[model samples]
Target: MGFSPDSFYIKTLGLTNTDDAEIWEYATTNDFVIVSKDSDFHQRSLLYGHPPKFIYLRVGNCSTSKIVQVLQDEIDIISQFGDREAESILVLS
Candidate 1:
């Protein structure tokens, strides 16, 4: 299944410039997965555990379409990750 950008992306939420801590809290409260390249989210997930699971991308800077393609390639794994209650951090290379 394709991910919906209007419902899932930070830019769509008018939060592109928002602080990370607030973004973390918002995701936690909203039952949304946080997709980011920033290592800070990975570190935070490690420290605080779940509620808002994080997907960390190690692809460096890339086009939006490239990011989507990477995510699509891992959709199965991501779906599995969502079903497991214990997994809090998903690292995508």
Candidate 2:
């Protein structure tokens, strides 16, 4: 997906490096979803809640082309997941 610098809290906050908790705080405050391969965010979502939903990619290391294709194919599902009230995390494999 195309991301503008403004779309990332890290960039907006002028942060070069930050911890997960900080990132979580930024996302929650800004109502931005967290998309990552790290399971940390997934675990955090389960413990806390969703204002900042999480999208976890379960697929193993792959080419960028393949990743893009998978995302493109699942765009509909992703969009629907974002709208789910009770769901905090969406795992895409």
Candidate 3:
């Protein structure tokens, strides 16, 4: 399932250029999954565990299309990861 930034108050709350902590807090409060390529989120996931689960993309320096393709290809695995109770961080390489 695709999510619009507006649905999570990302645009409404003016989260542009905000720090990771604020974004994390919002995600936690709203029960939204964090999908990012940033290691900061990955580290936070490792430290805090979950209420806001994280999907860390390990793909290095690629075009936006490639990134989207990778995510599309792995949607099934990603869905499973999101649904799993014990899993919080999904590192997609």
Candidate 4:
């Protein structure tokens, strides 16, 4: 549903069901960084401008653990740039 900011972790919002736009809005409202495999998120970010922050993984392919670690590794770095009024995007590969 949602994740704790301390965790900087994703609470899988589900799949084959939830719409990307809804998820995007949810992330913005909840102040949760989206950790998704879909490239659509990036496209949407550009189209709608941006939220406080976003993380888009451009890795071709990888294990879930690897993806999670990538996010974990950058949590602090990204957080430093996070601001409610300042939208941002962090791309990791």
For TM-score, the strongest prediction is: 1
Each prediction's Cα lDDT score?
Answer: 0.88, 0.79, 0.83, 0.66
In model 1, the Cα lDDT at residue 59 comes to 98
Better of 1 and 3 by TM-score: 1
Q: Model 3: residues >4 Å from true position, as ranges? A: 1-13
Lowest-lDDT window of 10 residues in candidate 3? 1-10
- Tell me the tens digit of each residue's lDDT in model 2 across 1-93: 343333453555675478999888888888888877778988998899887999888888986567667767888998899788999988888
lDDT for each residue of candidate 3 in 4-83, tens digit (9 for 90 to 100): 33334345568988999999998999888887889999999999999799989999998767777887899899889978
The count of backbone overlaps in candidate 2 is 0
**lDDT score, residue 38, model 4?**
80
- What's the count of clashing pairs in each model shown? 0, 0, 0, 0
RMSD of candidates 1 onward, in order: 2.2, 2.9, 3.0, 3.6
Give a tens-digit lDDT track for model 1, residues 3-67. 66434677767888899899999999989899889999999999998979999999998987888
TM-score of 3: 0.83
lDDT of 4 by residue, 1-93 (tens): 122345443334443476888777777797766666688887887777667356778877887677767767776766675643565667777
Give candidate 1 regions above 4 Å deviation.
Answer: 5-7
> By lDDT, is 2 or 3 better?
3
Which model scores highest in lDDT?
1
Q: Residue 43 in model 3: shift from native, Å?
A: 0.6
User: How close to the true structure is residue 6 of candidate 1, measured as C-alpha lDDT?
Assistant: 36
